[model samples]
Target chain A: MKNIFTIIKKEFSRFFKDKRMVITVLLPGLLIFAVYSLMGTVFSGMESVDENYKPKAYIVAAPQNLEETFSSILEITEKPSLEEAKKAVTEGELDIVVVFPSDFSQTIGTATPPDVKIFYNSAERNSVYGYTFVTAVLGQINTSAFTVNAASDKFDLATGRDITGNLMSTIMPMLMFALLASGCIAVAPESIAGEKERGTMATMLITPIRRVELALGKIISLTCFALLSGISSFLGVILSLPKLMGGMVGAEAAAFYSVGDYFMVLAIIISVVLVIISAFSVVSAYAKSVKEAGSLISPLMILVIVLGMATMFFAGNVPHVAIYIVPLLGSGLAMSSIMSFSVNPLGFALSIISNLVITAAFVVLLAFMFKSEKIMFKK
Target chain B: MTEILKVENLKKSFNLSRKQQKLEKTYQKVKVAVNDLTFSAYKGEIFGLLGPNGAGKTTTLRMLATLIKPDGGNAFIDGKSIINEENEVRRKIGFLTSELKLEDFFTPNYLFGFFSELYGVDKTTAAQRRQVLFSKFGIDKFAEVKFGNLSTGMKQKVSLVISIVHDPELIIFDEPTNGLDVLTAKVVTDFLEELRAEGKTIILSTHIFSLVEKLCDRVGIIINGQLIALDTLENLTKEKNLEDTFFELYEKTTGDRI
Candidate 1:
């Protein structure tokens, strides 16, 4: 255990003491935050403009009685014909062209409802909002008239649910996994195989420490450093996620998850990081140089990415308890479950146990490889 | 004299792949890297294992250091078996070679403390030892400099200090002065003599004849994975000078074999 701490201290100092490593670990998160915040600001600005700015509307055969209602919301412009109004809308001079039947107000409360034709550009945000707003306004007028005649009570119901949380839960699991995997890839190989390539590992091996202790030390040290990098990247994404979502999902929806859900996610992240670092350590032990280790680990990184993406597809669905017995896949499912607010304790337990077991197995394998002179001193 | 290290016919063999055999232009697939090599080093003496490159000197040293297990037979370091009690063997011996390198990312001071801790040396004792070694090697001036930034001679000196950080009884160094300048070489040779004077057992492998003449009290000449000759330098040189004797043995062995 003392030897393990010694190794961990060495690795920690090697990483944190280096200016370049600190920057590599932190820059991604800061950049993600800035980019996402900028996106959010741009989107919010567009939304505010869409809400307040009156879109130019041309109403053909306007009813005199309803002119007062239309005057407040729409920039009403006169057009000679329905064709001319549509041409103005299509040419972008008008946001929407509304064609109301000549007897639109008179026909209300009668046998048939009047046909109203509205034309607007669907590609433009303002134009789309203009069309929906005009139709809703006309419908409101019709409803008010009917309510007055029938003496009915007005009804309004709203639910305090965040629909965007579901979208975030579906996407965040995969994003988190990819970000953490990248963080591990950036540093773990250098800590292990780099020592071998530089011939420093032999110096360590000749010491009085047991091979198992050395392997344990390396694994633990790498786990802590890799976990920090992963967390930094995760924070970048999590803090900036609302902005990147462009308020399509309400920013408040990100806070909808309980604190316990975050703890559970963090637990899964740590477990996943241990598995990743251990697996990379084994690959590094097998490699002759840091470059070779990187080449070998690239395929494993891709595998992690593919497994994490499975969470996106499986979001909102309950995963089988057996799925949580797999390493990377289980962590992904567990995280997805937490974000979706349907976490299963048994699944999380199994996932954590499986990850730890896998990590231990890899470390043992690395220790055994360390004992083999041919492997350790491979040309 | 106390026998600090003993090798009893240690043997090691490696299977040459088809490609390796082809590259060597040989038909034998199994090559014996170390074969029935036997030697002993006493306390307060420098034992030189002299041989050409690929002559099993390193293989022998590696076995004694417990870096690789001998295929047959065994060795003892301070009475600890290389095979059965390697960790204990490691505690008794300090092995240095060109292949065993200090990490370029670390400084000599940090590595000294790290190895001392691994050897279970007490902090105060380690600190005292580090101070002594740092001053002895002139390492105090650049104690915090990264190993990679040091000159080759400086790196070698630092490596030697770190190897013996725990003050082991037996020291194994392979070609300690292989790449040193004349002045640095003198320092290393003088240091080995100084350690010998202080009653430390030292075993070193070298092909340099002058190094052997200057530092070795005893010499073992190896060829083709076998120790062909072993004796004190005075006894071996009684017939002729050591160089002529080595060449004569080399020619006789090669002429008889091929």
Candidate 2:
């Protein structure tokens, strides 16, 4: 046990003591935050229009009742020629062209009303807005209609907590798995296979500890580093998610999840991380070098990514409890349940237990591989 | 003198991959690395296992170091079986080879402490021993330097000290002077003599004839995975030099010339 601690300390000293390794671990998270925040801001910028600016449109044969609607939200102007207005609208200079028949509002009571053509470029944000306002105003002509959901208040009955839960449930499970898998990939190969590649493993092998102790040491230490890395990345994704959602979600999303829920999520994440790191360690032991280990682990990472995406497709409560014992995919399913506020206690318990059992099996296999001379000494 | 190590019919062979077989231009599927080898060394003298590369000297050291296992037989280090009591055997011996390397990211000072702890050395004794060994190899000045940043000779000195971090009774060093400068080589040769004087058994494996003559009390000559000769340096080289003696035995065994 002391020897295991000794090896753990050595691995930590190797990772945290070096500036390059710290950067390699933390930089991805920092970069993710920076890039995602910038993307959210850029997307908002490209998709929004100024409230004070009204969209300008050309009226070919302007209906007189439409004048009131244009005064508030639309700038309807008379053009010299319809051809010129179409050109301006196509060229993105004009917002839209509402070509109406003369006295079109008077003929609206007829069973077959003449069509009022509202042409606008869907690509332009303001133009799309302008087109919607004009169509609504025309639709109101010659009818005493009750407005459907016309009040300025928010109409959806779902609370802020529901919105947050829905958003997180849709995205968080995939993000968590991918980020944690990345963390495992970043550290496991370097710690295990890099030692083999650089010939440092044999140095540790000559020590008096059983190879199992060394295996335990490496997995535990790497789990710590990978957890650190995963948390950093997870923070980046979580903190930026509100903005990425175009202000649909924010810090309030965290409030929806109770401390118990958070602890459960953390537990699941740890289980997932253990499974990932242990599996990677086994592959790394079989591989001859860090590069070869990476090659060997790529397929597993892909499998993890696919399992993560599975959480996205599994909406609402997972119907069957069997999915909670499928290792990586199971943890992901449990995490999604937590995010969405539908925690199945039995499934959650099963998932965590299943992951831990798999991790132990993987560690045993890794230790056995460590004892193989050909695996350890192969060229 | 009391015997510190014993070997009996130790054998190891490897399955050659198709690519490896093609490279060696041989159709044989298995290549024997260490074959039915046996030898012994006493508690307080230097014994040299002299062989050209691929004659299984390093493989034998690896087996005793518990880095790998022997296929057919077992060895005892101070009566601890290499196969059964591997951890105990590991505690009783120190192994040094090019195949075992210190982490480049670590300074010699850190690696010494790290490996010392792994060897279960007490902190006070480890610190005191570190002081002595570091100063002995002039590693005291470069103790804080990373292993990669150190010169090859300094790296070698640090590796040597790290191998003996627990002050084991038996030290096995393979090709200690194979790539050293004259100064570092002299330091290593001098350290071996010093350890022997302190009553530590040392097994030195090398191909250099002069190194065997200078430091070894007795020598085991190996060729083609078998022990071809065993004698004192004086007995083996009484009439002819060690190299001429090795070639004559090599010719007599497999009828081959280097």
Candidate 3:
């Protein structure tokens, strides 16, 4: 155990003692924050409310009651015929066209709900935005009219909290998983294969310490550093989240998570990092040089990306407990579960256990690789 | 004198690449690095394994160091088997080679302490040993300098100091002075002598006969993965000078005169 600590100390000093290494470890998180914040700013600008630029709408048989509400956000022109309005929309002169039945206002109190038709080119940006604005105004009118006239209690309006929750579950898991993976990839290769490439590993092998101890020391230290980088990048994303989400559908999604939620996130991140470090250590041990290590570990990056993307659909809907035991897949599911605030501790426990087991297996494999002269002393 | 190290028919073989076999125009797949090798070193003596390049000196030393497993036979260090009790064997020996390197990111002082801890040397003893070795090697002057920035001589000195941080009973050096300048080589040779005088057992491998002649109390000449000769300097030099005698042995073994 002391020998393992000694190795850890050496590995840590290898990175922390050098200013350039420290920068490399820290730079990714800061860059993520900066880039995400900038993206949010640009997207927010794109989605800014343009009070002066109203959508040009042509309406037929326009209802006097709802016309005032629609005209507030749209430049309305009464059309005599639906063909003229349809042509205007297709020709791109009109952003949207609304068609109403001749008895639309009178049939509102009837058993049948009147049909309202809206037409716009989906591909045109102006038409899309105009369609969105007109629907929002119409939705408000429908809600008000239904509340006053209808005797139903099943009216469902999604609250900001629900919208934010959906956004958090859908996106946060993928981002967190990707950030953790990138952080581990950044340093694990250099810690193990870099030493081998530099010939320092041979010197280490000649020491009195057990080979397994050396493996443990390296994996532990690498895990610590990788976790640090992963968390830093995660925080970078979290801190800039508001900016990135500005003008997004659920801009207030940041408020959906509590302090306890973040702790769960950290726990999941650390567990996942252990498995990453161990796997990377084996890859590093197999590589002859740092450059080769990088090349060999590139496929693992693609795997991480795939796992991260997998979390998108799995978020808030993780299946069986068995699924949480499949290494990266489980961790991704666990991460999605945590962000969604629907985490089953038992499932997370399974993920943590499975990852730890994988890490241990990989560590043992690394020790065996260290013991193999063919691998350790390969030219 | 008590023998602290022993080798009994130690053997190691490696699979050759298809390209190498084609280049050699041989269908042989396995290249025997060391074959049925047998020798021993005693306490308080410098025993040298002399060999040309690719003659399996490094492989033999590496096996003895327990860095690689032997395919056949076994060796013992201080009565501990290299095969079964590798960690015990490791504790009893200090192995160094030209192929080993210290991390350039670390300073000599830092590495000394680090290795000392790995060897389980207590803090006070490690510090005392560090002071003695550092002063002796002139490493004290640049103790804080990162190893990468140090001169080759300085790096070699630091490596030498660190390799024996535990004061192990037996020390193995593979071409210790292979790439050193004259002054550094002298320092290394002198240090080996000093260790010998302190009653430490030393085994080294080298292709240079002069180094064997000057430092080794007894020398073993390995050629083509086999020990062709082993004798004291006096006995080996009885009939001819060391160089002529080496060539005579080589010619007898390979039917090639050089």
Best by DockQ: 3
Task: List ranges where model 2 is wrong by over 4 Å.
Answer: A35-150
Q: Which candidate is the best by lDDT?
A: 2
TM-score of chain A of 3: 0.70
Lowest lDDT block of 10, candidate 1 chain B: B249-258
Any residue pairs clashing in model 1, and if so which?
Answer: none
> Tens digits of per-residue lDDT for model 2 on A30-105?
7777777776566531345667778898876665655766776777666678777766765557888776667566
Model 3 ranges with Cα > 4 A deviation: A41-160, A247-255, B22-25
Q: Score candidate 2 by TM-score against the native.
A: 0.84
Q: Model 3: per-residue lDDT, tens digit, A243-355?
A: 76553434455667888877887877888888877887899899998899889888987787787778776545666789888887787788777765677898888988998
Off by over 4 Å in 1: A34-161, A248-254, B256-258
- DockQ, all models: 0.66, 0.70, 0.74
Q: What is the interface RMSD of each candidate, in Å?
A: 1.1, 1.0, 1.1
lDDT of 3 by residue, B1-258 (tens): 999989999999988898989876889999999999999899999998987788899999999988889999999999999999988988899988878888888899999999888888999999999999999999999999999999989988999999999999999999899789999999999999999999999998988888988999998999989999999988999989888888899899889867
Candidate 1 chain A: minimum summed lDDT over ten consecutive residues — where?
A: A153-162
Cα lDDT of model 1 by residue, A88-198, tens digit: 665557778776677777876677656666777542446667877877877777663322212231110011122234444666667767777777877778888998898
The residue-by-residue lDDT of candidate 1 on B75-179, one tens digit each, is 988889999998998899999899898877788898888888888899999999999989988999989999889999999899999989989899999999988
Ranking of all candidate structures by their TM-score, best first: 2, 3, 1
Whole-model lDDT values for every prediction:
0.81, 0.84, 0.81
- Worst ten in a row by lDDT for model 3 chain A: A147-156
